[model samples]
Target: MTRTTPARPVSVEAVFPELAAHRSRTTRLHPRPGRPGMRDSHVGGPMLWPADEPWPVCQEPHRPETEGYAPDEIRSARAAGTWPASRSWPGGGTPGEGGPVPFMGLAQFFRRDIPGLPAGPDRADLLQLFRCPLTHGSYLERRYILRWRRAAETEDADDFLATPPQLPLLRWEDELPEPCVLHPEQVVTYPWAEDDTLPAALIARIDAWEDAQASRHGREAPSYQSDLSIPPGWRVGGFPSWASTGPLTVDCVSCATPLRLLLTAGSEEMDADSHSWVPLEDRDPSPHANPTRLRFGRDRDLHVFTCPADPGHPPRWLLA
Candidate 1:
């Protein structure tokens, strides 16, 4: 519940109140390597599900029905806080080894912790996102969604048996996410892409402000718009630094309301030169690598966008 500090630290509405309407907010799930338990905001952390609830499965099909199985070597390695020495990957295989595989916990959010979340699936308190491990047709991975009551609501949360399915994995072989505590910092952000742009009048005003700052003295004055915080590493709110593709916009198909950035999935703990994103007080002195071996996609990022006006609206994912 700490106050959000922007990277460059500027107030958006303060300079131009007109631009307020176009302003958007995001929560960076700053994931890292740690031993986060079931009741924590973390990526790849332990799930707080009902012990008796049947684990999820993927019935989705794949290219060919070629099937073979690798034992629990990788799982054992992950449990031991390390990666397997070797893996048996599918050059081309069926949807699964045989039966349905369980989904792995990707992200968890507490309703009480985040203030702006719309009414979502798990009408209770906890929002858990599970990704099926099987690779479907043409690398299509299936996802299992669970919106459930908070772990605190259940008395036997710690005693529950959470199962992660054994399915085929590719690049994420070494990318086993460790449980890390979330240090939520709420920062203001602007749409960096033309598709997610402010109104023309607002853009003009921002241009004028940039011009004024340009005329101001000293090298510290903002020259480029990016001089501010396009934070690297794992963060919640703020503009995303696009790589493969630029900033994208996915409107709520049902309501047509512009979706907002809900998550930024990255492999590393910190991107180079994003020293500002690091919290003032952090456990690790060397912020370069996360002790957790999780990578979003090798070194790429996965951006998940959700509806701003309606939480019931389906979300969209963009790999940038």
Candidate 2:
């Protein structure tokens, strides 16, 4: 089904004309629970992986005693309405031991389906996302794996793995994402209210405007942050909301080039406070607000930023 965002109650540009300069477009990937295929743009679905190419895996060390289960097994357990106490741990060994731990297929996006989706190296048309079930590094971050492939090349491969080995031992059950189909919709968005790029005087004016609005309309009064600035959901290529942690400067470590937001996996399609962002078709109050059912750290949104100068550079992620 096609999802459409309702028109903004108030014209932000009309109220703050100078803020028009920061306006940009973002593609909302309205993910709904469904059966997604290998060739389709989807979340937690089969990917168009080359048959001969070896599947990617996580080599980082994980506690050998932790309970583990593969993605497919997890789905099966969910269907059966019973999560297993323990599952076969792949590449099992003692603590600090490392081996081939299969990575879960998180998401896949085709340039043809999503507008403003950043191009991969060599102008590739498909972007595949993967994540290790285990947390790694000092921050206990879930490692994200990216692959840029040509859809045409995988079409006539000698053979493909209809069912790839689900070997990764997921540490957290919440990390597993249920399969979801995408309904891509492009919409206008502006930077966060606390974005450092905006001039201080304009911010002061906006603060004054917000205060006056509160006085007039009380809690329901439209504010720049929640109602006008950013839409909350899984989206591609737009400004990131720093509501949780103020503004942050994200730059490429390989080079000094400023990075751009590539994708965001938010917990909610629209929160209670940001009802304006709810799609017209889904305006009716319902429990389907979180179809994907995936939650990030502390229920925060995961924002991935990529280097514009070189797509091959490692992308950075921020949980905010």
lDDT of each: 0.58, 0.81
Q: lDDT tens string, model 1, 1-320?
A: 34243355456556767656555665655555567777676766777767767667666654344443343555577678665655445765544545565566676777666554444544556667666554555655445454545445663554676665455653345434556666665555555533345576666766776778767844445522444434555555455657566656668888888776666766565534444455555545374355345555446666667666766678776666
Error of 2 at 53 (Å): 1.1
Deviation in Å, model 2, residue 280 alpha carbon:
1.0
Give the C-alpha miss distance for residue 168 in model 1, angstroms. 8.4
**Candidate 2 residue-wise lDDT, 1-320, digit = tens:** 99898899899999999988989999999898899999899987888887788989888875454456565667788778688455655445323456666777889999999999978888888998887766665676677778888777766787877876654556656667888999999999988876465888788888899999999999899888888888888999989988777889999999979999999988777777788888888857354577776777877888999999999898898888
Clashes of 2: 0
Model 2 clash pairs are none
Model 2, residue 306: displacement in angstroms? 1.4
Model 1: pairs clashing at backbone N, Cα or C within 3 Å = 26-237, 27-236, 28-235, 28-236, 28-237, 122-147, 267-295
Backbone collisions counted per model: 7, 0
- Best-matching candidate per lDDT: 2
